[model samples]
Structure formats: C-alpha cells, structure tokens
Target: MTILDARESGLANGGPSFSLGNRLLRAVWIPVWRLGAGWTPRQLHPWRRFLLRAFGARMAPGSDVRASAKVWYPANLEMHEGAIIGPGVNVYSMGKITVGRKALVSQGVHLCAGTHDFDTPLFQLEAKPITIGAHAWIAAEAFLGPGARIGEGAVVGARAVAFGELEPWTVYSGNPARAIRQRRRFADDASNS
Candidate 1:
C-alpha cells in the first residue's frame, strides 16, 4: 500500500507501523524545530507555515499560522482546507495529526501525537496520530491526548481533556471530556445550544 493508506491503517490499528512512523518523524523533527526555535514570533510563524506546506500539509489559501504556536513535524501534520488553528496552539505531531476541512482548533489547544507504551520494559515512546474530523470545534485550552479522535461536527468544550473517541455531533465538556448533549439543528437550538 501507499504511504498515505499505510498511515491510515496504522491510525486505525495503532500497530507497529505507527510506532515506526512516530520514531522516524521524531528523529527528523527535533533538529528541524530546533533550527527555527530562535526565530522571533512573527518570523517563526511564517517560516513554519512555509515548512508545513513544503512537507505536504494540504493547507488551503488564507490559512494563518501565528508564530507563537509549535508544530513538531510539518510534513507529518495535515490540516485540510479552511481549517483554523489558532495562535499559541501546539500540534505536537510526533506520529501524524490530520485536522479535517474547516475544523477549528482554538487558541492554546494542545494536541499530542505520541505517547509511551507502558507494556514495554523501557516505557518507550509510541506514536499514534490524532484525527480531528471535519468542522469540529476544539475550544481553547483543550488537550487532546495521543490517538484521540474527534468526530465530525463535534464540539469539545473549553479546557476539556480528551483521551478517547468523542462521538460526532455532540457537545463534550469537562476534564475527561464527557458528552453532555447532542447537537440539534443550529437554527433551532441557537438560543440554548
């Protein structure tokens, strides 16, 4: 299979392939992020933006990357068309992170793409991509742990900590990200939703 398909399958299975990708990406990422680490906030954002595009992140026109945010591997992180990744947000993609089209990742959100394997003797690092579905909204200060999945049109409340699958079209809130409600029609539920 092609690399993209392989990555997708690995994301599904969290198997050995994903682990290898995480290690390989981390190997290249540390030095690259270090090189640009000294940049001024303004300069750093644009440079990182360029690197992300160069690495094949399919960003659309007018996507803004503020200098303050940190991205581990530009090539390994994919934000689709019209996605808004706000300032100060860190996408620590040690494996792979795919943010779908028109998704909103608010300011200061932390999405970790790798973790440790407790089953291993050394507690070695294990990489798994975090997938944010289309049109999902991850509020400010939310933390998405490794291998977390946010479904389509879901809303992750502010400061929520999500370490597992979040159902689609629902509103999830609090530290462990419990789903509090399902989303109804936007026009119908506007007042209380």
Candidate 2:
C-alpha cells in the first residue's frame, strides 16, 4: 500500500486533512446513513449495502455490513463477495480498506487506515491502505493499524492489536498480535468454515 503523507499532500501547516468536496460529501452522507440504514434491523443487510454503495463503496454481491458499523469514507472501502463487517465495527478508511472474499471482521473491531507521524514536528497525518485477505477472521474488538495486512484464512483473536503482515492460515492473539498457531487450510470451502 502507498502511504500518503499529509505534509507532502499539502494538508499540514494548519490545512484541513480532507479536501472541501470530500468534507461536504461526508457531511451529507452522515445524516443520510444515520437515517437511511443505521436504524435498520440486523437482517436488513441489503438496505445497508445499498446506502453504502450509493456513497461509492465497492461492495460485491453477498458482502454484508451491519447497521451499527461505522464507515468513515465509504468511497475508500471495498468488500469482496461474502465479506462481513459486523456490528459496531469502525472502518476508519482515511485511505483504502479492502476486505477480501469471505473475510469476516467481527464486532467492535477498528480498522484504522490513518495515523499521525509522531517524528514530525507538525504531527502530519499519514494514511496507508489496509487489506484483509480472503477467509480471514478478525475476532471481536481487535484493532488493526494502518497498512496492516491480515493474510488469507488467518484468525486474529479477540481484543488483539495487530499491525504489519500476518502469515496465511495462522492464528494470532494478544496485544501486538503474535502468531499462536498455524490454522488448518481449507480448500475452496472457506464459507462453510
């Protein structure tokens, strides 16, 4: 993923992090989403998907996002077929956030694609894309930092904090998540598992 430096992008020096048009769209989207799908029942995935897609999210057929999930920028999100973003998940898509086919992000997970550059005096913002590979399972309340790549079929345990790349078919747990064990690889039936 390409990192976007706010200082180089002209967003530092007291400038706003986002362009005017982007802000305006978000302003309009906030209430639209709140009233349109936020109050819907959990079973109304299609309605929620429609609202997200209207804001430019690339949601494949069978991809599901819960009504309570908060997406910072729908335009920066992409969900492959059968991908699920569970209730109360926060998708802070300052950059792009891609959920691969059948990937499941559990409740209250934070997928943050933006952070501040602490070394810089100005504390400039930096954004990098996050990718969750196919069949990956992120357990409840986990935190994924900017540029995190959860490999295919990997499982991140509940409340874990993860950054960087995780190996495919691995089980990770704890703060600054470490691989706990190798998961059994499933062949073409990821949905069933």
Candidate 3:
C-alpha cells in the first residue's frame, strides 16, 4: 500500500509489465520504424501504413501519420479512416489507443497510455486505454493521459492535459482540461448560418 511496503517486498519480485520478447520486438522495430517510416515523404502514406500494420497497428486508408510522429507500440494503436496524427506527436501506447474517423491529433500532442505508480518503491507500471472519438480534435501540445477519452466532436485546446473523459461537442482547455464551451458541429454551421 505504501512505498515502504513495496520496498520490503523486494525489487527482485517486481518485473517489467511486458514480456522479454515484446521488449526485443520493440528494440528491433523501433529503429527500423524511425529510419524508414518516420523519415519517409508525406505522400508515402501507404508505405508508412504498411510498416505500422506489419507491426500490428490497425489503421484505415486515408489516415495520415506524419513523418516525425512517434508511436511507442504499434500493436496497441488503432486509427480509423481520415484520422490525422500531425508532426511531432508522440503516442506512448502501452495500452490500447483508438482514434476514430476524422479525428485530428495536432502537432506536439502526446497520447500517453502508461504511467508509474508513485506509491510503490519499485514503481509498478500502470496502463489504461485512450479513446479519441470521431471528429475530435486534440490541439497542439496537448497531453492525453492514461484512460482519457475525448468524445465525438470535442476539442482540446493548446497545451491542455486531459486526464479524464471529455463530453461530446465540448471544448476543453487548461492544464487539467476543463470544459470551456460547447463545440458546434461543423456540419450544422452551414444550416445555422
């Protein structure tokens, strides 16, 4: 329950969250993915998609992953059609991450599905899934923490950190990502005008 208790339990008993084979797979695939998939031309989406898919990612056609974006584990990632992961995005998907259709993850965004339990001496790994719903927008420099969910048409403003679920058609901002306003559906705008 406490750090002291964890220390008394012994570090030898505590182990990595994943298997050795999984670690080895990442060791081999990371460099290759960085070199090949991360430096390719923006137009070469299929090639990049192929690389991700080969490593077990589920991505639909027309989903754009920028060259500079980093995915920690492709096996835990899923992107639906028209999803866009912009430049400098880091997806640390230790657990499942699903991006719905037409979702936009802007530049410098970090989607982190893993963290360490600070209460323990060994710092046991804690992981949870992240979901970005259809037409949701995670703006530049935003951070989506473990178990965060951005609902359909929601927008997370620049530099915000989402640690909980966002409501559909809402706009969020600030460090902990508070709801600031309701988002209007773009499709309804033309009719409203």
Candidate 4:
C-alpha cells in the first residue's frame, strides 16, 4: 500500500482500537455509565458489576470499580475478587488489562495499555497488555503504561509513572518508578495462602 493509504488506514477506524460493534457498545454504555450506574450508591455495587459483566468484563463479584472511574472497553478488562479501582481512575484498555485478587488501584490512577507507533508517519495505534498482580497497590494518580506489570504485593507511590515490570514485594515511587524498599509481609499472608 502507498504511504498515503497506510496513513488513511490508521484513521479509518475512527481512532478506536476495536471493531464497530465495540464502538457501538461503548456508545450505548457511556450514558448508562455516566448516568444510571455512576449515580448509584456504593450499596448498589452488585448492579454496577452486572453492567460491567454484561458488557464483557471478566470481574469477580467482590471487585469494586468506583462511580467516577472509566473503563474504555469492558471486554479487554479483567479483575479478580477483592480488587478495587478507586474514584477518578481511567482504564484505557485498548488491549488486555488484568488485576489480580486484592489488588488496589487508587484514585486518579491511569492504566493506559495503548500508545502510538511514533516511528510511523501514520501514528498507528499500538496496544499492549497490563497486569497488576495479587495484593499490589498502585497509589493515587499513578500512571501505568502499556505492557507494565506491577508484581505481586508491590506498592507504587502517588503520581508515579511506570512503563515496565516492577519487582514483587517492592515499593516504588517517582516518575518512571524506582524501587524504594521492600514491601513488608503481613502476618495474615500465610493464612491467606
């Protein structure tokens, strides 16, 4: 294909990572997400979880996604039991995003699993999977980029930006995220396992 054709192809999908059906699904879901589900009390969490599942998210019953949080495509998201996505979080799941059991994604955190191929003039969309392991905690306002993996029991500090795999049982902080210290193991850890 010609260079012009390649460029046109990138934009042809209307900036969506998925198919027309997915776009239509989100179109329908947006209203419900912002109005109906978003306004519901925390006591009505089951109802909200139903909506996410109906749209294809593989989430366990105990997981909680706050009212203000936004998940781009439910089909590309998965969260295990006890996972919590706090208020104002944005999960740009252009690809797969998995949160393990008891993982906590704090308020205003951004899990962006999509980017662009800057090398190409067309700036084609590139999607990668993000995985947060069991008991990991992504602190408020952190940004986890495509292909980032927060290992089991890891803790990410506020406003940190992570673009790669973080070690297990570690504490990370700052932009680009550095390992600050080892995460302390809980007394109940053995009991849970």
Candidate 5:
C-alpha cells in the first residue's frame, strides 16, 4: 500500500493506545451500568426519571428525559440547564459524558464513549470523555464516538458520526463528520435592529 493509503487507514481506525483504553473501559462499565439498569425498566419512564435524579445528572428544573431514551450510567452523565435528551437516544457513557446547557440530543442518537483494542493480550479497551458544549444540537440518529468534543452552538446533522472535535457554531455531517458550513447567525443585536 502507498503511504497515502496507509495514512488513510490509520485515520479511519486509531492507534494501539487509543484502542486499548476504549476496550478496557467498556468491559468495566457495561456490567456496572447494567446492574443499575433494572431500577429503570425499558418502559418505566417515571422510574427512570427518579433514578436519574438520584444520580448526579445535574438537570435543571423542568428538563426532561423522554421515556424511550436510555442512560447507561446516570451518575457519570451530566446535563446542564435546558438540555434535552430526546426519545430513543442512548447515552452509553463508559467515560465521563457532559452535555452543556441547552444542548439538544435528538431521537435515536447514540453517544458512545468506549471502544476496544486489538493489539493487547486482553484486547484492552480505551475510553475518552465526550463533551457537548452549550447550545449544541446533535440531530436525529447522530452518533458521538469516543473523544468527541462538540463545540458550543455546533450542529451535528442527522445521522452524522462525530469522531473528533467539532468547531463552535459549525454544522457537520457524514461518516467521520466533516464541517459542512457555519451555522446561521441569530444575534440579539440583529433582532433589535
């Protein structure tokens, strides 16, 4: 393979260190979260709501977690004021996950925080924190992979996979999620004018 082809291959799948930690984190977290999962059954929305509240998910008053949404670890997830984790969204946070104020994680979106390594003896897993900045919108069916750091006011378009950092106020989409364009401005001064 040419140098360019090898480089492309590396970009698609990360290196050994990255892979190792992701796998280990997932192995450790899944069972721990699953143990707590029974407190909130698949259909029991109210029960789930209470469980999340018991954990340290700092939801502001009146912020809602829809029934169909699943939080793998309520204690490890933090949602700021006015954040909406909508229906059918799965927050699988083996690593620390934070969603800033007014961020919207729409329906069927998967926020994944862990992956496994192939190089290690045990196939060690690596985990990286996922952060969605304030006012960001993760549209329907979008997936935020490990180490995804979505910037403030950014929008990941429907079905996008944000594998890395996203620029603030930018719109992104596609498999690895390239920046599409700057989001439209809606300044307070413009409204006044």
Candidate 6:
C-alpha cells in the first residue's frame, strides 16, 4: 500500500485533497448508495453487495455490509468471503482497507485509513492502508487508526483503540490496545463449531 502525502501529491495550496474525478464518483455514489442500499432491510445482503460492487468495492461472495455502515470510498475497500462489516460501522477508506476472509468488524467500529500529517506545515492529509487478517474480530466501538494491522484470529476488545501491528491469536483491549492474553488457537478449539 502506498502512503500518500497530499502536499507532495500536488493537492496542497488550498486545492481539494481529492481529484475532480474522485469527488465526482463520491458525489454519485453517496446518493446512489443511500437510496439504493442504505435503507434496505438487513436480510438483503445480496442487494447491498451488488450496489457496493457496482461502485467498485471488491466484495467477495458471502461478504456482508450492513445498511447503517458508512463506507467513504467503495473503490478502496476489499472484503474477502465471509467478512462482515456490522451496523453503524464507519469505514473511512481514504486509503485501502482490506478485510480478510471470515473477519468480523463489529457494530460502531471506526476504521480510519487517513489522517493529517501534524508535523508538516500544511498539515497535509496522509493516507495509509489498514489490514484486518483472516478470522480476526474487531469488537464493537473500536477505533483502528491508519496503518493498523490486526493479525489472523486476533481479537480487539470492545472500545479499543488500535494502531500499528497486533500479534496473531492475541486479545487486545483499552485505549492504546495492549495484549491482555493470548487467544486459544482456533484449530485446537473444535467446541466453538
């Protein structure tokens, strides 16, 4: 994933952060998504998926995104099979956000893939990618900052704020998420099934 510096990319000097084409796509997408899928019933996953795909989201079959969830740029999203973006989740995909197979992003979670470069004089926007590995679970209300990488089978507890890399098969919680415990290996836990 490329980290974009808005200033260096010629978007500084009071110019819009995104190109006209990007703005135009979003302009058409917002209302289309709202009218076509945002108010649909929860059971209409296929319908929602179709609209998302039409807008350039890479949604694998069986992936589900709730009606109340807000995806900033569908073109920057990629969800593998069985990945679920729950109700009220905010996918601020100013950059790429890849949700691996079977990952679950619970309700109210905020996946922010962009932030301002505070040290820069222009305070220019910086876009970095976020990745949630296969079988990971990001609990309700969690905030994942730009460049966060949640490993496979990891659990980010409710309301946690995560940044950078989280080890696989671990449980993390709190504001600056820390490993609270090592998660039991899913392969060894047949009881869940």
Could you tell which candidate, 5 or 6, scores higher by TM-score? 6
Worst 10 residues of 3 by lDDT: 1-10
Give the Å shift of residue 87 in candidate 3.
Answer: 0.5
Worst window of 10 by summed lDDT in candidate 4: 1-10
Provide the lDDT at 130 for model 2: 91
Candidate 5: segments with Cα more than 4 A from true spot: 1-49, 186-193
Q: List pairs with backbone clashes in candidate 1.
A: none
Clashes of each: 0, 0, 0, 0, 14, 0
Give TM per candidate: 0.72, 0.93, 0.88, 0.88, 0.71, 0.93
Give per-residue CA lDDT, model 6, range 117-154, as digits (tens): 88878667888899998889999999999999999889
For model 3, residues 38-86, the per-residue Cα lDDT tens digits are 7788899889888899899999989888889999988889999889899
Residue 117 of model 5 has an lDDT of 57
Per-residue lDDT of 18 in model 3: 66
Pairwise TM-score winner, candidates 4 and 5:
4
* Cand. 1 Cα-lDDT: 0.72
Error of 3 at 110 (Å): 0.6
Which runs of model 3 end up more than 4 angstroms from their true locations?
A: 1-12, 188-193
lDDT of 5 by residue, 30-63 (tens): 5544455434444554454555766556555445
The TM-score obtained by model 1 is 0.72
Which parts of model 4 are misplaced by more than 4 Å?
Answer: 1-17, 187-193
Candidate 1 vs candidate 4: the TM-score winner is 4
| Candidate number with the higher lDDT (3 or 4) | 3
The residue-by-residue lDDT of candidate 4 on 1-193, one tens digit each, is 1122333233655553345676788898888788878887777777878889989999897998888899998888899888988999999988789998889999999999888778866576777889998888999999999989888889999999998889988999999799999999765443220
